[model samples]
Target: MTSTPSANLFKPLEAGDPAVVGGYRLAAVLGTGGMGKVYLTYTPGGRPIALKVIRPEFSEDLEFRRRFQREVQSAQRVQGLYTAPVIDSDTEGSQPWLATAYVPGPSLGHAVAQHGALPLRSVLLLSVGVAEALHVIHGAGIVHRDLKPANVLLASDGPRVIDFGIARAADTTALTGTGVSVGTPSFMAPEQASAGTVSPATDIFALGQIAAYAAIGSPAYGEGSSHAVLYRIVHEDPDLSRVPAELLPLVTRCLTRDPAGRPSLTEIIELCHEISPVPLRQGEDWLPQAVAGSITERLRLPEPAKTPPPLPTVAPTPTQYAPQQPQTPPPTQFSPQHPAPGGVNPYAPTGFSQAAAPTQSAPGIPGPVPPPGHPMQPTPPPGYATRPTPQPGYHTPPPVVHAPYTGPQQPKKKRTGLIVAASVVGAIVVLGVIGSLLPDGSGKDDESKSPSGGGSSASSTGGGSGDGEASGTDAGKKRPDPKPASYQGIDVTENYLVMLAGDPPRPEEGDPIYGGGDLSYYVDSMFGDTWIGTDNGKFILLNNSQKGSLETCRTETRYTEKITLDQLSAGTEFCVLSDAGHIAVATYKGKGGAKESTYVTFDLTVWRNAEEAKEED
Candidate 1:
């Protein structure tokens, strides 16, 4: 068979280069690496995708090809909003490649290198986005294995995880090559450095280092050679002083040396929200779009009617697969000439059939009964079967297997007979050794055990009760009863609630409370909605939509006397009114000591209108 043309291999057809291998028309070179080159490619249609072609030398290695196939399967398992979905793959082709949805943006590393440190807002967004990705990846039982700045992209909409070529499943058979390590050294965990093992915690540690790098524009362990960085990861604590104080607790949790101690991805997402300006919402419309004109320019090509056919399957080589199980051992038979002594015998006749005899009983349970064909043989009369005579420094032979025989079985046998026998032997040995160490109690007098003052048992019990009562009385005198109804200065109305600085306010359940923060911050709402104050002093506005889903709005405003609901303005810009009649806004006012109010306005008309609409539908 003749080999394919070299010029046609992974060459772009759209750039005045001839179409190569199988009708694929590569548009632009995306990136090149030691293993392969990634190219921006398109079908006959205008749809664009990123295609990676494996290097020729790497393709020759069957083991590498198998791993690549497994990677494709693992990558395909990731299904979430933040992950770039895997579209197709050609694992068996001359140059195996996988295609994923083309995400438009600079790699995080490139973004940081060009733009310097990201602002706090962007970092928060990145943290939440990446955490979401890891959550999905981990849920699928796979580790990204190489989570680094280069593998993370700052896309227009949000952060996206890319390059899962080396991802491994928790239960997968793939093993790291001896003396070989994967992942960038700067971000690897100590366990990863020592080639110990990788797990979800490994990703958490890596994320902590990444967060530290993002915060300070430097690695948490500082700049150094690969070896030095690896050493620090294995032996040193990460420097997290530059991390924002608010986020320090979360970062510390993630940087724990023990994998079991790391906080989960969900916890990291919550931490990001704690420091973010935008409260996480399900349908927030702030998703950034791809950079203007970038996707269109990159995907320039005629749209094909359909995706290319999958490549033919290749038979895996012998060395590429793991050995099958159920390994069988050589069979051996019992030797009758073996000697038995001291009630101990390795070849003792266990009450089991020949077929089941080889299998040992579970650690503590007795062996199963022998099959009907294999009955227990009677024990030989004492001295009939000669016990081996002891020889100086000579090892004795093992016990012989007895022939099967039918006989009356022993009923009601005690399960702990062996244990009792061993215990009795141990007790006799202990008593002989300790018999002289303790004094005899024969001289003790029964009268000496009586109370010094002669008294009946009933009298003694009565005295104890009196003493107990006296101690209880003294303890009660030392501590006063707590005051009832601690909150005295707050007020609650049907529509709102107010908390005074002097005392915390208490509201009965179902009461619409407001006024922890800027109560005057006006937000437009659908008709028939209500707002309530939360224990955190923020207001939660609820729209009584038919669906019964509540839209929550958190405000930064603090409750103060100076602010009022009437002073706030209503407009489309500062409010979000759901079709079911819910609206909310976040507002804050005044510095320290200044009382701020969060004003929430409910529109009964909008809710009524939504109800009418639903009725019409």
Candidate 2:
């Protein structure tokens, strides 16, 4: 049976209707939930922002309002490169509302539904970004009680964390009322399912589920009724077999049933870095881009159309056979005349014998005897009582009788057909086995291609091949290529630290700093603050707190040349008019960038080389 469509699904709205609350005017409705509506609104300066207002019933509760106010305050303190920052809020207003920087992108749920699960690289990036966000939030003594795919946004830059309404401060006395369960069942941690106090580890558990979903296109625990899902969360192990072998361990750690057993967000960040090392080339950023024409030309192929042939028809064959005739009786009494003594009658010659004789007596023998030539009838004996005679031309076959005898008989043609069918199937199976054992020889082009140029020999190396050998030529004795000489020395410039690495002749002794290519890399501390950047237009601000390391960075918005950062210095923020009649800002801090100055930006193509030497545990 079809399900009833949800009332919130694609509801219409009239133009010019005031969808706003307080000072923020809602340009469009972004989403809705059990609590309230989220609108895509604008700030006074026309900067796009997401505005969330409480439901009218919840707004009247002073305690809820106070709790929400504290949540907003705590959310505002979250500092990272992967979280949206709270731009403004008015808890004291008649209709309380909170506005955050609008991150234009699809929700993780929407993205996964539309495009299937993300690639391994993208999943890695998402996990790292979300974990970093959680780390920042937890460091500020806040626990995001509701961490699900719906609250995660996949912006062009990377994944951004959102939804802080139900978040709780670690030291606050405020708690959700009894019987009010929060969080999506599929993404909740064991403690959260049991309605126990949530911690940063809870968010980590939720992130693990989200990662599993992103990797396998479904939740690891599977989907069903909410109660069933919650029970599985508490009592069952997730199906992590579909997860990439390289990431299974990390995901398993995050999904440990015991909250205390789960890895910390700090550990998650390190794992992400290890699994998905940042590439060296800036052009290899995760952002989607159209392939070059030449590349597409090389990969494109035309499909051939197939058509079925007409079926043949067969005609039915006719057979010729003679019908049997009944024997006639003698003229005197119109009855079967007994053979002289033991001699058989002339009509019952050869195959027809006494066994074929009818049991009935002489026909038409009565007081009014019928003449001969009339149809034959049975007559009773004088001493015995007479019975009514049966009508002529009506005959009944005698009951079948069997004699016990043992002898072999030829099998039927139908049985032969079945044997032929079974033999054909067996032949097909044997041929298939033989084919699999033999070498595939349609052509070299039809053969499987390996990452290495050599054919798939037993000793062949590299990926995309069937051979079970290492990719490197000197697999047994090879060491990693050394970090470039250019990257060895450090150069500090205004707002940057440049490390230039030169090419090496062979492998390096220790872990290489930058082996992929010759590029200027920098890590420097200015006024007791560390910053890393490339000579190219990329930078990462590193902030160390008692909790962990936080990284933030910013890049210009495409088409408008607006420099968007994690946080902008007050006097440095300004707007410029674009040539295309668009208003562009000189610099604007990203949610994470504005809150904390930790940023990371670099060429990601170098990762391909690093991945070659990496081993899965």
Candidate 3:
């Protein structure tokens, strides 16, 4: 198992390592921890896999075996980036073992240790991806008890939370031994250190620590002996002075000793997204220069063959070893310092450590190599987020599972990468009013009463098709022109679209239109795909507000009541409010309540330019 496979992160297997596990040939060592040893292996099809063989002590225990089986089953259900998904397992065997998708990226600890504090933007993107992964992980009912930086793999896609060895289903019993704490001291939550009930919040606390470490290049709690660090985590306030100011509040909130006081994963995503929502595009480098170089070194291994012998199952063998999904690496180079189009350099240059890392150059790496004379002020190759510069050295998506929200999901027919601008964060924001977009900023006074704040109203959130609220977008023959067009009080262009939150209601009145309704929009787009954005509350417009008068429309105004669409969030009902204060549950016509925008799956209801949009009945 010492053939030097996998990217730079994996090493030659030791003498004690097994040559094969469950029919998959072990190639090298990925990592080792107190829980078990992780080896790099490949499926019969040549797809890389990380095989973790549990120690005899843990596997021999009947209770541990059952727990491992259940945990692995639970881990298999988890498909998001928070933790690598389980590909296969053999808990019933003498020594329980599990295999997962292999990520050719460095751990956060190694990246930070080699390069110093990560750039502010990288930290923000890291937060978004990790938080979203946590959201999905929790949704799967699994709590990753061990979520330290070492457990976080920096893939070409984004940060991937891995190593579910210590993870347990929230409904399971604690696996505590006599005075045993099953976690890294510096990153453990106070409750975990004190042997209290471990919950999702424990992971939140560790996330704060990860953030602090990535930002400060050291533990948030001053480092010392294991006991001292554990004590500090349990008793002392974290030293966040070194943390960046923009991230201070959220980071502080995550570190709150009281689990109840800490912000929920939802809040953390919202807040961190407000600071930096979009992360690196697939194949876009997010690690420091030295670390990216290491990743390149690792990717030198050839991809797992299309079809390898299947894991020992009573059933037939798989023709291809790779995951069913197509993970073609982008034709780009590796230059974390400069991102290609549709991308950005998430790494910050603050306190950049220049220590020479042990890692070597990857084959055909898209990295920034210094020129003959001048310093390495290299321009990154065009990536998905930006225009595609199909050059050498660019990272492709490895088999490793990444944060749920991470990865490059391009818009239909567009190959561009995505870049979620940091400047946009507010979940709901009102761009400048467009006189033409809204029939009239000041609607007919008699018909327009402030929007109804009453109980019976409708709102459109993330994903929904019910009650004809906001239907999906129809890629009708109509394509938004790049030229700015005034549509419904927003400046519209091919690059950005303007969306509105229906008019508000006046006091004591139910919604005059459709009783009462709320409006929200979300633009999940890739590069060259126009997106209706929100940087938290950065860009906002009050409901029923006047053309230039913020005082005019004073009905039901609440920016927090907004929803971006997603497939799982369908059936949520919402009314579309108009400037005239008319509420609409759905833009349906007949008794069946047929809907428009049947093909659309985002928050776009109206077009600012009348020429392009034909409002159909």
Clashes of each: 35, 38, 87
Candidate 1 residue 338 Cα shift, in angstroms, is 68
The model with the greatest TM-score is 3
lDDT (10s digit) by residue, model 1, range 143-252: 77778887786666777887654544211211221222335778888777644567888989988877777666777887678767876887789888778786687678
Q: For candidate 2, write residues 1-617 as lDDT tens digits.
A: 12232233223335623433443334556677655567665543445567676555555555556677788777778767888888766665555666777775667787777667777788887887888788787787777777888898877667889875454421111122222334578998987764445777888898899999988889999999876887788778999989988789789999999888998878887887777756412123553332122122222221111221222222212210112244553332111332221233222111111322322334642222232223333232222244455455334323349977778787755788889999999999999998876756766533434334355532333433322335444377433322211111122222322222112212122201111112222222222322221211222322222111111111322222112332333223332221111121122222223322333232211111222211111
Looking at model 1, which ten-residue stretch has the lowest summed lDDT?
608-617
TM-score of 3: 0.47
CA-only RMSD, every prediction: 27.6, 35.0, 26.3
Better of 1 and 3 by lDDT: 3
Decide which is better by TM-score, 1 or 3: 3
In model 2, which runs have C-alpha deviations exceeding 4 angstroms?
1-19, 165-182, 277-284, 287-617
Report the Cα lDDT for candidate 2: 0.51
